[model samples]
Target: ILRETETDVLVSYLPVGAEEATKWYVEQALTAGCAFVNCIPVFIGREPYWRKRFAQAGLPIIGDDIKSQVGATIVHRMLARLFQERGVRLERTSQLNVGGNMDFYNMLERERLESKKISKTNAVTSMLDHELDPSDIHVGPSDYVPWLSDRKFCHIRMEGRTFGDVPLNLELKLEVWDSPNSAGVVIDAIRCCKLAMDRGLSGALIAPSAYFMKAPPVQYKDDKAHRMVEKFIADLMRMDPDTARKVLNNEITAEQAVQIFERLDPETARGVIKAGIFNVEGLTPIRGAAKVAREFGVDYGKFTEEENTYLRGLMFLFYAWTRQNTPNWFRYITRNPGGFLAKFLAPWFAVVLWNNTIDEELEQSLPPWKRDQLHLITGYKDEDGKDIIIYFRGAPFVDALE
Candidate 1:
């Protein structure tokens, strides 16, 4: 069917009872050159062997389990985060789910529920900062009710202690249509897989998987996962085929690709600068000067007389006397200098030494004749009309007198 339809993506909604069949289905999907979206609790996306096989085949795969739009797992995870953020120590939690769907009926075989339990448990536990004992958190399908039809009910409770050892507890009851709860999430995941295929992207997509799946290839905080997915979608929309290829090949970042595209439009380039995207400090002077010249169409060499004079004075203040300084030193000062005068003198001259014993030792080490010459050159005269050396280290007078 995949070969005949030329399917771009394969959505796996198989039940846990068909666990052994998933391997054959995955192999078939890979052989058919279809991107795989694992919507079940099986561990294809999380397993290293399957991930590497899909990556080697150059096909994108997303998921280990689908997440509902507003399901019991998400509510429990959010409440856990709230408790942690409010300085409450979460001691124990549990979620009891009852549904009438085939999913719930299939889960009646407890032997098939180990993965489901682990997946849902980790979905909530990952939001916590502290370790939770395995016995403390219970999350799994509790019962099956034939009369409820498609309706599913979830009861979640969290037990914790607040400051001053005050006990705090929360309980929530969620009623949702079991199948439809995850239908929207599965659709979004399929679309993400299709987008990755269109962009020639291979391997597990971290952002979409983290945002849409219960047990993804990698887990991230919900807010961070949302932002990553947003950026991923925005990048796909902004990048052309070649740019997308470059990004997937690790040649450039999404921001760099955006900049490359923005540079083509002079107005956008100006807007980017105005928005302070590239107006950050610590940029190379030459690069900053060139950007200004190129964007505004100004000739840097043809400055006005006042501007030229100011520039000359600035250069003199920055680099007037450095005979022994390395080229790298000048490059470093050009980007990050303590003071303008520090560029011309030794790098250590920028700092004021506060050790009187070191100052005295330095003074005693200087030859009397050189000290006299240093004082004479610097024009230093005490009340006795004698040359008095303050500190000879890192001083311009030392080189001048020498």
Candidate 2:
């Protein structure tokens, strides 16, 4: 049927927890040379085995679970991140969602909810620096409200300690149209999948998945993921075929981009450098520190104290990531250290006093992205350095910014 319709991408919106059914659909897509967008939690993109299979077949797949634009997961994530950014120690939190949709009804069965629980839990917890005991952080569907018909009501409560160990608590409720809430995001995911196909890229598209899916293989901070999505959308249209291949290198296609990413130790620094937005080349990863500021422009004058501090922390993180992951990357640090701390840290001391970030900064429950795992540290170039595009792996569709 897909072949007859000339389907370019196959999106599976099968019943929740239908792994066997989803896998069957995946095989159909694979057989038909089509990209896939898995909207339900069946682990096609998150699992290494399935990812490898998709990469070898040269097709992109973007999800274990889809994230609605401003849906429950995203709201929880943003609020949780607020606590972290504000120095509030999140002690306990729970998100109880009740909807009138059939999705809520299907979730009544515990057997179908294992993956759902994991997906929702991970989506929110991935933002925290502190680890919550399994019992402390509760995230999952609660009950079905037949009268609410496609309307979801979410109640959230957060308990934590503030400065001087002062007790602080927050509680809020949100009501949204369950089905329509995901329409924008799902449409965007579909478009992104098509974009990946057009580029001849395959496997789990890190940037798109991170921004649009709850259980992407790699989870980046939402702000960063948002920028990555912007760069991703524009990057492809700007790059020619050969150059695009050089920059985006989907699914470890070449293992490394020694071509322009410049090898530090092909063994230790097992990662890909994406210069799609900046359109520059041969830039040291050190200067990548000011990426957020450069990309989004943190107006020091306009930024609140909290915003500046966050930006500073992000810049500092870029420094530590470089020092720990690829020390030799310093060869070009003198070029551009970024506007955030260009004068204070650049030529020498920027990386000196940097402390390590918590591992929870990335994935904690699932496979953490180690040096051996395929890592795509995508960002824009702060300046022009000849038009050079590269990729070892691949992606899928949604115009997130749109």
Q: For each candidate, give its TM-score against the true structure.
A: 0.66, 0.63
Instruction: For candidate 2, write residues 263-360 as lDDT tens digits.
Output: 22322122222432112344444343334234433223445544444333333223233334442233233333323332233223212111122223
Off by over 4 Å in 1: 266-402
- For 99-191, candidate 1 gives per-residue lDDT tens digits of 998989988999989889889999999998999999999999999999999999999999999989999988999999988888998898898
State the C-alpha lDDT per candidate: 0.68, 0.66
Report clash pairs, candidate 1.
Answer: none
lDDT of 1 at 274: 47
